[model samples]
Target: MQSIRDRLEIILSRLANRADEKVYTKLYSEAARAAADAADARQKAGVGLGLLDGAIVSIKDLFDVAGEPTAAGSLMLASAAPASRDAAVVRRLRQAGAVILGKTNMTEFAFTAIGDNLHYGTPGNAVDASLIPGGSSSGAAVAVAEGSSAISIGSDTGGSVRIPASLNGVVGFKPTARRVPLAGAFPLSMTLDSIGPLARSVTECALADAVMAGEDSAFLQPIALAGLRVGIPRGVLFDETQAEVASAFEGSIRKLEQSGARVADLAVDDLIAEMRAATKRGTIASMEGAEVHEDWLAAGASVPVDPHVSGPLSRALAIPASVYIRTIRRRTELAASMDERLASVDVLALPTTPMVAPSIAAMTGDEALRDKTEGLLLRNTQAANQFDLCAISLPMPGMILPAGLMLVARRGHDRHLLGIAAAVETLLGR
Candidate 1:
């Protein structure tokens, strides 16, 4: 088999001019070549390597790579000082022998769930060219979906990682927030931010998560659906799912049941209520993002901001400080609720995105459509962040367009979540 780096070069050459906007920035060919050479050399040395050794991984532009300026999909940072060191997670990946392919585009400052970035350009949806490839980890998913890399690294403050992974038909994992370090990565919400992997398979995501968390990948047991308890929350998460998405999610559940997993309906009324109330008040993402970017905005750096990206982010900043404070308190309360409520179940399953991928035309420029799309995109996945739970978005089988069946676990139960996800993946045969 060709090394991941060799495959990436072929994919890059094939896609170089096919779509003008799918990828906004790319590393110099020489840099990629050198990484590829080093990977091959290390393999030939007969040294046991890390999980990602020789794997080509694409990163969202928000991560700081030494000598390269962190753009976060905003042109405003084009002239900012180049980073002198890699983000902690990036350093870890490099130490594990993963090749840094290039930085992928994202929603400006990782603010919006919609992947449309006007400055760096939106990554075209691989399954359907006209549809939106959910953001802000847009290009990260695109890189994997289009086979440009074996996996992509993206941050999920509130479903940024999972939304795109769902829409693009890949696996996305968001470990419990505190389990993965966030140092050196650009912040969206310091409290909610998590670095996770987007890969072709759930097992691959598990491997990546192990590397990020500095855990032993060998200890992650394969999932066995037999006798496992799966919960279906009986509220808002199911309220607005599109027919296709609903059917796919339901079908996946039925398959799991048939494969010996015991599925039950559970009420998370209070959690849903808190999430609704929190949305009205603005989320941790919006509040913390405003705090982090305050200085940049004060310096009149808005001109280079992508209208599609900043338009939504600017609205987030409009939220009152009082509301933000209350929301943070509520987030803690909800986290406590999740710990108690999910104590009995192995995993809570839901549709990763409430709706399927929307048309790119529908997501761009129109404020109402943008808001609607953003809300729908992050609806199911955001609860994981709100409650400080670990979650994974696994691609459901038989969907023409990518849709994820999300599995969420209780706080600090990262390993258990991976086990459940692995079992679910086995049951689903994907």
Candidate 2:
């Protein structure tokens, strides 16, 4: 069998041109080499290696590393001081023996769902160069899909990780909020922000989540599909999706039934509408982001913000403080309602992105297309954030490009969600 390092080197060579868009700001060749050396030494010494030993992992630019600047995809922070120490999650990954491959690009300050960074060129979708890779975890998904890294860490506030995974044909897993630590990482929305992984398979994502969240990896056992009750939201979620997405989702539902899983259609329209209304004023992300960047804004340093990222972020900051406060309270109510409604189901299913990836030209030039793309990207995934649910996006088979099937479970049930996702992946034969 080929060693992990050899596999990584091959992938890097194949996907190097994809990096022309600056999806990765730096490459950690030295760290990767060092990891390979250690793995070889452990093998020779007859010592047991960790699950991710010698595996190459990519980091989103938003996370701090001892010597690198956490640019968060903005020229505004180009001159920012280097981090004195690794972020908490970085340290954890290092301890698990995973190599730090490099920092991947992202939407500036993680402000938008559509990945188009003006400062650092936008990361193109792996499936189609003309389409977007989705944000703010754009490059993280690209790194995994293009095979530059086995897995990549990404922060998801409102679908950042899952959106790109859906667009790029990879697996993105977002644990329940607060399951993973947020310290030493750039803040988007403290209330909804979560650190997770993007990888090629559901199993790989689950392994990364286990290490990052300090959970037991043994919990990811094979699960039976029979009797697994899955809820399908009947209202806006189904109505709002495009024809292609609707057809693909229906086909997936049929496959689950063939595998002997029980599927039921449930209505959560009121909760979905309430959540959308809550976001109109401002989300926890917008409120927290304004506070985090207040110093930069006050010092007149926000001028160089990436236009693609800044437009949405500026609008978020413009929300009234009273509205922001009301949104937070409403979020709590929404989470409670979701918990009660989904108590009996093992998981809830939806289309990860209501529409497939749009052309990069259309996204950047047309405001209407951009808005539609962003809304579609977040429509299904945002509910997970609002309800503090654990969710994962797995690529749906038989799609022209990459489209995703999102699986959501109750908050704090990360382990259970992973098992169900594993079974679903088996049913899809991917």
Question: Which candidate number would show the highest lDDT if scored against the true structure?
Answer: 2
Computed on alpha carbons, the lDDT of every model, listed in order, comes to: 0.82, 0.84
| Pairs of colliding residues, candidate 1 | 115-135
Can you tell me which runs of candidate 2 are displaced by over 4 Å?
Answer: 11-21, 315-320
Task: List residue ranges in candidate 1 displaced over 4 A.
Answer: 1-5, 17-21, 307-322
Taking the tens digit of each residue's C-alpha lDDT, what string does model 2 give over 77-103?
Answer: 777899899998888888888888889
Clash list (residue pairs), candidate 2: none
Compute the lDDT of residue 189 as modeled in candidate 2.
84
Q: Candidate 1 versus the native: TM-score? A: 0.94
Q: Report the backbone clash tally of model 2.
A: 0
